[model samples]
Target: MLTGGPLDVLTGDYLAELTMLILGRDRLRNPDLGYAKTFLRQLEEGLGLAHERGVRIVANAGGLNPAGLADAVRALADKVGVPVRVAHVEGDDLMRLGAAEVPEVPEGPGEGLPAGASGEALAGAWAGALTANAYLGGAGITACLRAGADVVVTGRVTDAALVSGPAAWWFGWGPEEYDRLAGAVVAGHVLECGTQATGGNYAFFTAHDVRRPGFPLAEVWEDGSAVVTKHPGTGGVVSPGTVTAQLLYETQGARYLGPDVTARLDTVRLTPDGEDRVRISGTVGEPPPDTLKVGVTRVGGWRNEVVFVLTGLDVEAKAELVREQLADALAGAAGVSWTLARTDHADADTQETASALLRLVVRDPSPDRVGRELTGAAVELALASYPGFHVTAPPGPAQPYGVFTSALVPAASVPHTAVLPDGTRLRVGGGAGPGTAAPHDPRLPAGHGTASGADPLPGPGVEPAVPVAGGGGVGGSPAGPPRHDPTTRAPLGLLAGARSGDKGGDANIGVWVEGDAAWEWLRDTLTVEFLRRLLPETAPLAVTRHELPRLRALNFTVAGILGDGVASGHRFDPQAKALGEWLRARHVDIPTRLLPPTPEGNHP
Candidate 1:
């Protein structure tokens, strides 16, 4: 909701990415006006909230223009008469980094997943770095607190680092205690991406007033564990269950990794303590592998999203005819490219003069060449089919298009920070690394696996594991109707967004599915009722119904707690993929059954 990019903001479908040549992996704060507006609004509100609560502050709301944004805030401080000394942590803004000085993408050969190897080369080194902000560690923030900054405005600091920095300043912690700092860092990570997971982009919210989902308020303890809450009377729920649900959003099996540590995220407990309150605790943390993390994307080549409003013709016959003509027109195309998918496909076979959209993807290293070849495709459509020119192919040749490449940058290359700007001196309380564990020598590194979203399996006899070893169920359920809807509400803008890559701290769940079939319609409308009934019946396992596109299929992840090994992430493994193959190979007795909807008639 606060940032750009569909995938970056909301969770849904992202079919594929065209390969991008990496120019460089540099991080910098965006100076875009829109981002700054979002930052300023949140920082002011978060500060107001903290001020009311008698909490001190230093912040990084400077998104794109650290100094410029800071200057405006400084004017505000002058009005409030709060003498705040600000520190601006700099040097990682890649827009300033030279290409010759461009660092190499980290990742030794064969260290990452099959798709994980698309290093920064795809970005085109000649272009160099645009932004290089990392989720910062605790070191720099400590300086800001000591310098006595009334408020800190920095560009591209880690979200969790904002909170953890204060903690370090409050307690004077050293890097040798990085694990404890990491623990607090993880806590901050959970809430950094904005609203509570329960309401923002999270699927479990009962009545999210997205219109006004208040920004989360985290209360960190000495152990590095924190409780996530939100402003009173705001839209959205704050409970252990909701937080736990969020924790499971992106994890692969039972693994949770930090730059210096990987937590075996067990001991997750959610319980209702009172109205709109839940406590989430994760005390057990693992050490991170000494390997750099990176993001990799590949361009499978070019594809034109040609949408057409088809009408007036033997729909199927005309479509086939058009496809043939276009294919023929692209006869010498490096790779023959053609598809005949029509909207309301059910009507494609019998309808005459129906509306439709056609998409064609051309694959080649030379985007210009591919774009050139498409010209004939347009003419064939107009000339080959009945009145085709009057409709889809009207008097023009398809134009050339540029395709983007894919690439990655190492974690070391991503800069993080804490700051004490020029005129403020405010002490940032709290300490870093109160609970971080040491690295295990045999650790597997981050970025070695695929992006999450695999379908889930059925688990057997599962329970919510808590990090504290024993559980005191810290959250509660609504005894009455929910007070607000997090989805429909406006942003309280309590906190500005944290640095780039800071989105990695929250806990996630990984579901598994085997293959792609009837994928566009998750589980073929198997229905949530079936999932609900199936869950209780499993007895010893947990059951979660999700639309998992990774498996390219609808999946039911059953955890042992829900009585099956599905959502629990136990029993499933790399070897189990063979089991998926076995299932695919066998005949399935699937029913074309209707699925039950929620009482409101919305499909779950």
Candidate 2:
């Protein structure tokens, strides 16, 4: 992109919950191998070009070792004959806090750690934690940029910091410029996921050529608003629908808390600027919580799984027989999970089509329990099981998986530092004020807490109304009953687009439509109760519904849906990447007027 378009700064995000654990393991094996090696390779090819073009590069590819990665970058610059000035932000690592000093894991909305876990359990987990890094904000990165660093790398900063940091530096935004900072934060979020803002993973992806969706960029102004667009001639698209989908991805409630500022998601407005460009404006911001989120990763336990193919007739009977036979062997395991996927068809079909799969997953602290014993038991059934007995693959030894938990600590307690290109370390402090643990805004009504079932925050341009007995309002406003328009039972995707993703153990599904009528219908119809009925897995979990009226969208956050975050592999879709698509596929009584016109000029 440096050569493709005019740019002042370029940023890359390469870290995730699982990646942090992997990097922690890498550091244990080799002291200097915690950063992303792929980033180094990319720099070898592009660093010279970026320097020649005077484009400052910011990336959180530093992973667990920003200092080490910074050194690596300097060495690569010398080798490539590029005069690049590199800096890194650090002070995010918290392993220095001994197990006894480690704080108890928080169990708020998106936090992945098990709720009500005992102190002893937390201590044990902390003692063995592979990593415990606080999520730092953009101040450190801004400091690095202002200090004349050509390249800035960071460890465990919020992903959006990659953009916000540069924008802050460029615009000279003060720490208290809540509105402007909030705008930058919103833009940062849209750009942080790379191609997602450009239609990758969009519910209506078929509408565009995403075969090679180009990365997205934001043109931020001094006032903090931005126009999200991609380079010309690039694949994929950047429209209001696409931008709205991204805005709702993995976020919960009206307040999107970050280390810097809490952005009001409900206040965000999106408008079409031009072809392949969406203007983002009017975002409200509030002071961030006094605490910072810390992610702690540890080897949870060993896990093993086996998939049994039950073919042709009596698939259920075959599955039951196998389950009964292996009951004794799996009884000793700490946790055993079974799933029966009936991907079978009756009469006149191919073998694959007529087969069902019964999968068994076991987890235990002892490797032998989940590995040797379980694998042996499953293998023994191969010869003695029901007719047409076959396994998808031979069961392998159990592999250790990580669990990610979140905790909050006073922002003042964590030191944020910037290592300059001149080898001077600068301490960056939170300029927002005294970092004392503050209660959530009490003015924010009850059921507005972090869990599922939380009420939507009042949205911009939406007036308060009496709560109706059933879901029929905007922002829980009593907008009366459903419209008396003709309706058709169809997939929700026919009238709306969606984007869903995992946030630790929780999953968020943001569904949106294009017109006012559709938005009103969606906000009134897709309540927490209705959602639970559609996706039964969410019935028992806490679900929060957030309305973004201006964006014509509703965001639902399902807590504890993924158990212990993506690293735990708790569900088939561990990261909940396709949850929105699943929701969109479910049939709903969509208003006929809201549906798009077919080629025959009729709504399907």
Among the numbered candidates, top TM-score falls to 2
State the lDDT of candidate 1 residue by residue for 433-467, as single tens digits.
22222333233222111123111111111122321
lDDT of 1 at 383: 50
Name the TM-score of candidate 1. 0.54
**lDDT of candidates 1 onward, in order:** 0.40, 0.81
TM-score: model 2 vs. ground truth: 0.90
The TM-scores of all predictions, comma-separated, are: 0.54, 0.90
Best by lDDT: 2
lDDT of 2 by residue, 1-604 (tens): 8777888899999999999999999999998888999999998989988988899999999988999999999999999899988999998887855544544443331233464554455455456789988899999999999999999999999988888889999999988887788899999999989999997887777667889999999999998899999888889989887788888888875667888887877678888898999899888766776567788899999999999998999888999999999999988899999999999999836999999999888999999999989989888987899999889999999999889888765576577899998989998875343333334444333343222334543322122242212232223433567778889898888887888888888999988887787877887788878888889999888776766666777788788999988988899899999998888889988878877875321221
Position 339, candidate 1: lDDT: 48
Clashes of 1: 154
lDDT of 1 at 9: 10
**How many residue pairs clash in each candidate at the backbone level?**
154, 5
